[model samples]
Target chain A: MSEHTVRAYDRDLEALDRKISEMGGIAEKMLSDAMDALSTFDVALAQQVVATDQRLDVLQREIEEAAILTIARRQPLAVDLRECIAAIRISGDLERVGDLAKNIARRATELVDEARTLRAIIGLKSMHDLAALQLKEVLDAYAQRDAERARAVWLNDADLDALEDSVFRDLLTFMMEDPRNISFCTHLLFCSKNLERIGDHTTNIAETVVYLASGAPMPTDRPKTRSFGQAEEKP
Target chain B: MSEHTVRAYDRDLEALDRKISEMGGIAEKMLSDAMDALSTFDVALAQQVVATDQRLDVLQREIEEAAILTIARRQPLAVDLRECIAAIRISGDLERVGDLAKNIARRATELVDEARTLRAIIGLKSMHDLAALQLKEVLDAYAQRDAERARAVWLNDADLDALEDSVFRDLLTFMMEDPRNISFCTHLLFCSKNLERIGDHTTNIAETVVYLASGAPMPTDRPKTRSFGQAEEKP
Candidate 1:
């Protein structure tokens, strides 16, 4: 590749990254608003969250098209090619994160008119906070090309998974205590799961970032039987 | 873009599709076994599910390498390039589906000794059946270059989403009725959500197939809001 073409490809990649980051920013805000909507029962904010998802959808298409164009025109090799591919995949992940946040906001809207408080909201809040933090860290890792930071985010996904388990259990307790809360609590449960999944997708992006930077796959350890054997460990 | 090179590219794409089909077959079997593990509470089956995921991982890398090599060597243009790109993405989705199935099996192992019979299992089974069917349909669509079938699969995803909502509610009811069952119920809930996500990823692959076959971008619809609005209808 000529220097000019390489420069053009770099510029294209940087622009695509910026677009993904912008989508991430919107998704992060959506998550925060969804949580706030849940806490305050703000139906209007929840609606806004749902409406703004179209923007993420548009951005997803735009970034994907840009990546495709870059590949077609530049024929990027090795790391450059991986970076382009990762950018496209990361955009898909970010778009799904936006969708999950929208799901949470929609659930919050559902609870707007309910007369009773759902105990599951507390767990939802914890999940929301953890997912948002992971989103921010993973995006930062991508921007700085810090493979170590990306790996850290990948490892930290287990923390979110554990929290999700705790949240689900607490939600279950609420439902068991009062059958009346089943419908609302169930919505909260789905919302919490969506948030946890958003964290997982962000971790996927972090892993992709690490892979792009290192050209090495992430290590996989078999889940130890002892971990599942101990019932007292609490998630 | 000589005729000879075109034929070579076509041959390579066909070979890549065959490999992906083989991987998909293994993934579908893994999903079925994981569900079997859930139904029977068989820890051994769950362990086997986890062990087999490594094969999917290796297959993912192999397919990726093959796709990359074809792109580098064949230098396919336009629609051909898109097909190659889609092959890489669909393989990634297939691999993740395998991982999700392994996750379900892991959860089954966790709940193996639990005494309570969660009602959500029925709903989960329905979802598993539907997802596996959709995956098979999408793979068929890919093999036949059937854009219409791919679109049908896209439309079918909403049904899975509705089933997911029902399962979420049922699981919440189980959890709320007894805190003692919370741990087992939570694991089941996660497994169901994983199945739902696998369905979603399958839908994504279907969309990509449509795009590849038609050389047109797939449409992005607004997220389904009916489930969210269901909570308000109860009053």
Candidate 2:
């Protein structure tokens, strides 16, 4: 390939990275908006978050198309191929993050209708904050190709899982204490699971980063502190 | 490109399809074994299912590497590019199917400890069979590039969702009726959710098949009947 061709390849890859970062940004905002809507019961904001998921979905498809086109045009080998694949994989995870956030926002609408707030709501808020923070860090890691930072976020996922388990147990207790709480707590349980799922997606991005940088496969199991004995853990 | 080059490209694409079909077969077996373990409280079968997930993960990575290499080596364009991308996408979905099956199997271990069986188990078994059937049909559609069959599977997903919802409601009732059933019902709930997720992945493949055949983006929403009123329908 000519020097000019190399430059064009670099530019294409840069655009791919930028598009993925753009996706990550949108996903982050969607999550934040969804949480705010959950906290404030802003049905309009929740609706906006739900509507915005279409954008994320569009961006994902666009990235896939562009990546395929670049591969067809450039015939990128080895690292270049890995980078393109990583972008595709990471954007996919980010898109799911958006979808999960939309699901959470949908739950918020129901929660607002069911009750103003519940006892487990406070715990969910904290979990959401922590998860949002982790997502931001992981996205940064992907942008910077910071494997260590990505690994940190990946390791911290176990903490989120533990929190989720605690939340699940509390929701169960809440439902048992009062039959009226069943529907409400059930919604909250699903919301917490969604948040945890977002965390999982972030970790997936982190793992993709490690692969993009190192050209290796991520371990099947994350370094989770929790035992496998907990069957009621994240779904 | 020469005729020889075209032949090589065809051969690579054919291998990709065959690999995906192999993955789909393994995933189906895993789901079946997991369900069997759940039904019979076969701890060994459940553990075997869990162990086999690693093989699925390896196959997924192999598929990704080979597809990327093919993109680099052959530079597939247009429909060929679409075929390669579909293979990657389908394999990813199949890998998740394996993971979800493993999750269901893990729940089996807990379910066995909780109780031999319960009243709601019958509903769960039916749901599993329907979901498994959907998955099998969708896999066949993917292999044959039968968009019509894929569309049929896509529309059938709503029935699975309805069944899942009914199962969820029944489990909640069971949990509410007896405190001792709490742990057991929770596991079953997660198991049902895992099965539902498998159905979701199959629908994803169906959508990919549509795109590969039609050269168009899949519609964001499938032909879902029930109102979007339900919060827990899908991600």
Candidate 3:
């Protein structure tokens, strides 16, 4: 390839990476705000989060279209092919992250009647914070093509799983103690699962970053503590 | 283009489509077996469902690799390119379906303790049947390239959601009526959500099929009945 063609391809990749960052930035904010809405019962903010997810969806489709066109045009090979695939994969997962945020937001109104369970809310918030950070770090790693940093995030998923288990147990206790809290606690359980899933999507991106950096798929399953009890590998 | 080259490309796509069918077959069986295990508390069958997921994962990776290579070698344009991308997208969702099956299988043992709520079991079973049928129709739609059939399954998702909501309510009632059923009902709830997710993945394949047939993205949101209440679209 000539220098100019290589430079043009580089520019295309850079533009793609920038689109991912724009998505990551908005999704990160959605996660935080969804948690805040959950905490404060801010239904209006929750509504905003729901609305914002549509933008992410549009962005994902655009990214996928661009990726297909790029592969058709550039005929990327090996590492370059992997990078295009990675962009598509990341866009798909990021789009899901937006949906997860919307799931959390929907629960905000339901939490209004459960003021009694406010004490139990702290656990979910902390888990949300962890997930948000993971999302941010993984996207940054992708932007920098930083495999080691991505590996760190990949390994750190165990912490999010652990936190999820704790939250699950805590919420279960709340519901078991009183029948009235059953609905609210169940909603929290769903929301916690959403957060854990968002964390998993981040790890998916981390795996892609690692693959893009090293030109080999990650050789092992994602690190986890196993209490979720499904024996399938992450994609 | 020479007829010979066009025939070769068609052969490649046919082979890829066959692999997806093989995957669809196994995943559909896994869903049925997982639900059977749940109904009978047959942990061994459940274990088999979990183990079989590994095959689906391997198939997905193989499909993805082949799609990338084909794009690089053939430089397929327009509809041809969309077909390759569609293969990748379908494989991703099919892999998740396997995970959902394994998730259901894991809940089989937990369902053993709630014989009294066996009446509640029927609710979940019907919902499972609905989702399984949707999975079958969607895969067949992909095989036949029937966008209309795919659209029917996509629109039918709302029915599954409403069924899930009913099951959720019933199971919660069981747990609230007797504290001893908390563990069992809770597990059932998770299993129900897994089934609902399996339905969602089918719709995803449906979307891909629509895109594949039209060579244009489906320009509207999937149809749904509103009571599940989350404003954002399916993942």
Candidate 4:
């Protein structure tokens, strides 16, 4: 490839990366708003989340189409091809992150009239904050070609898993302590799950970033076990 | 493209499709066994489920590599390129479905000695059956290039969502009625979530198939409202 062609292709790839990060920014806001809606019982914010998911859906398709065109027109070989493929995959995962946020918002809408306490909301915010941070860091790593930064995001995923376990146990305790809490507790449980899944998808994006920087695929079988032993110790 | 090369490319694409379907078949079985482990509280079956997941991961990489090679060498355009790209995306979704099944089995291992009655097991079984069926039908549709069949699979996803909702409500009721059931109930809830996610992934594959056959993207923004309604109903 000529130097000019190479430069052009690089620009295109960078543009795709920027679009993905933009989508990530939107997803992060959706997750934060979902949690905020849960905490404040803001049904309007939840509805906003539901409505804005369509934009994410459209952006996912646009990113995908752009990636496909880049591959076909540029015919990037080996590492470049892999990077393009990873970008496409990351876009899909990020879109799902948005969907999970929307689901959390939906649960918040249901809980608006019934939620009496903010304990579950606090746990959810903890998970959401960590997940969104990981997502942003990983996307930045991809843009900067920083594999070490991506690896750090991968390592932090265990912290997210631990928080999810804590939230699960706390919700279970509340449901068992009072049958009247069942309805609200179940909604909180689903919200906690949505948040945890967002973390998982963020970890997936981090893994993809690592793969793009280093041509080796990450090990899929290594189980990162972080036991939340203090489940019963907290109120 | 020369006619001979075009024919060769078509044959290569056909072979890739066969491999993806074979991978899908194994993933479907893995999901089925995971459900069996959940319903029977069978640790041995759960271990088997975990063991089989490795094969799915291997097959996913193999199919992906093959798709990449075909695209690079043949430079297929338009519909042919779309089909190859769709194969890559479908394989990724299938691999994630396998991961979710393994997660369900992992949760099953924790529930083996729990004292909860088997009533909730039926709901879980129903969900597993519906998701597996949807996966099987979607793979079959992709193999046959039947957009009508693929659209049918898309419509049936609501059944899996309903089953997931029933499972969630049943487990919530169990947790509320007995404090000792909290751990098992939480595990069951995760299992149900995993199965529902697998269903969603299968729906994604079906949508891709529709896109490939019709040259138009499937509508992914129509929120399936019944999922929340089912969750709101009484246990």
All candidates: CA RMSD in angstroms? 4.2, 2.1, 2.0, 3.8
User: How does model 3 score by TM-score?
Assistant: 0.95
Residue pairs whose backbone atoms clash in candidate 3: none
Cα deviation at A234, candidate 2, in Å, is 9.0
Docking class of 3: medium
DockQ of 3: 0.51
The digit string of per-residue lDDT tens for model 4 on A1-235 reads 8999899899988888888888888888898888788888899999999888878778888888787777777788988898778878789888888888888888878776674656656787888888778878887887887789988888887787788888877876777777777668777777776776777787778778888989877777434664432111100
Say which docking band candidate 2 falls in: acceptable
Candidate 2 lDDT by residue in tens digits, B53-122: 8888888988887887788788877788888888899999999999889988888887765743368788
Q: DockQ score for model 2, please? A: 0.46
Clashes of 3: 0
Listed in order, the DockQ scores are 0.29, 0.46, 0.51, 0.33
The alpha-carbon lDDT assigned to residue A202 of candidate 3 equals: 90
Query: Candidate 4: which stretches are off by over 4 Å?
Result: A226-235, B227-235
Judged by TM-score, which candidate is best?
A: 3
Write model 1 residue lDDT over A1-235, tens digit each, in one string: 8899878888998899889889989988988998898888999998999889889989988887787777767777888888877887788888888888887777787786665555567777877788888899999998888899998888787777777677766766666676676567666766766776787688778878888889986765512223442221111
Deviation (Å) of B207 in candidate 3: 1.6
Q: What is the C-alpha lDDT profile of model 3 across B13-38, one tens digit per residue?
A: 88888889989999999999999998
Off by over 4 Å in 1: A221-235, B118-120, B165-187, B222-225, B228-235
Model 1 Cα lDDT, one tens digit per residue, B121-214: 8889999999999999998998888999999998888788788778776776676676565656666766777787788788888888988999
Please, what is the whole-model Cα lDDT of each candidate in the order they appear?
A: 0.78, 0.82, 0.84, 0.78
Per-residue lDDT for B157 in model 4? 77
